[model samples]
Target: MRQNPARRNALLDAAIEVLADEGSRGLTLRAVDQRAGVPTGTTSNYFSNRADLLEQLMRRVRERLTPDPAALAETLRATPSRDLVKTLMHQLVDRTRRERSSHLALLELRLEATRRPELDPTLTRFFTSDLDANVAFHLEAGLPGDRGSVLLLYLGMLGLIVDDLTVPEVLRPHGVDALVDSLVDRVFPPADHHGEEVVGQG
Candidate 1:
């Protein structure tokens, strides 16, 4: 396999676009090569097969969707309250919107996983780890919610992202931001008189 990190990532990024535009069925090695504007067989040089390509693509999607560390640190500096959760959720929605192709490619990969049993385990592990990390972060951040709250928020945001990408018209009635605010308000526990305590401050 090729060992050029930049080239490999470029191929995976191209694959993401192909998956988004053509769905799993159309994601042939040749298609990735063409989308990437590289020589024929370039993708094959990097990825051994369709499954290998898919596994890499899944990882790339996570990398592309990960929160900006600087922004996250800035947000973490504030008191963790319903408002903070709202801010986090809004940032998530914005990131999804900005990386529309990555999100759509993720949806395609999910559907493909259902048909390919071999792919399911890898996909499941990736999603499970992400959920676990989110739950851990919520707890450590002193966010205004328990595990159930985090789970509900995750489900709600997943639905919202799917709608926003696939059928945005559905959310047009309420708008995405307003719906995010509602999700935070309804899913998280209300702040007490003193407000939610900061993560480390007395």
Candidate 2:
């Protein structure tokens, strides 16, 4: 019910932290209030209930993870190629690492969604729209891939992120950057002289 955008955003940010640190079960108005350093009942004033808080947190996480428009525009100016896709993937990995808390909170929200059927539709919509947008972007940019390539890239990067965040040790030997490069190379392999994709080529 509160109309103060800044305060509401602060509360949502705090909720993200709480979700990351304590999981969904520990998310409560009092916990958010303490995390945000606000007075008791402050969060309740902003969020109607636990479900409302979770929904808002999901939106906030998306906002926090969005790519920088200026940087994206700069990248788009370069010729579209596998290198360009690698650059974008690197940026995504870097952003995910930098916004560790938000990403972790996102994982928590996804897990919570499994138990709360009411959340399925919202999460599904968000993921589906994001995938569609990504596919459209790749096609428009003339990237070296189709919808299937984009989907594979998405799944590969998602797995990389999960492993990088949850268990870096597993990938430390291969290195995150190397793994990303490998993922991009495999998903968007170089084309042959005839402009046909060469799959499984060394």
Best by TM-score: 2
- lDDT (C-alpha, whole model) for all candidates: 0.90, 0.91
Model 2 agreement with the true structure over 116-143: per-residue lDDT tens digits: 9898898888788778988898899998
Best by lDDT: 2
TM-score to native of every candidate shown = 0.92, 0.96
Those runs of model 1 whose alpha carbons end farther than 4 Å from true positions after fitting are 191-202
- Model 1 per-residue lDDT tens digits across residues 1-202: 4389999999999999999999999999999999999999999999999988998898899999999899899988988788888989889988999999999998888898899888889989999999999999999999877898799899999999999989999999998999998777777645457887333222
Lowest lDDT 10-mer window, candidate 2?
122-131
- Give the clashing residue pairs of candidate 2, or none: none
Candidate 1 global lDDT: 0.90
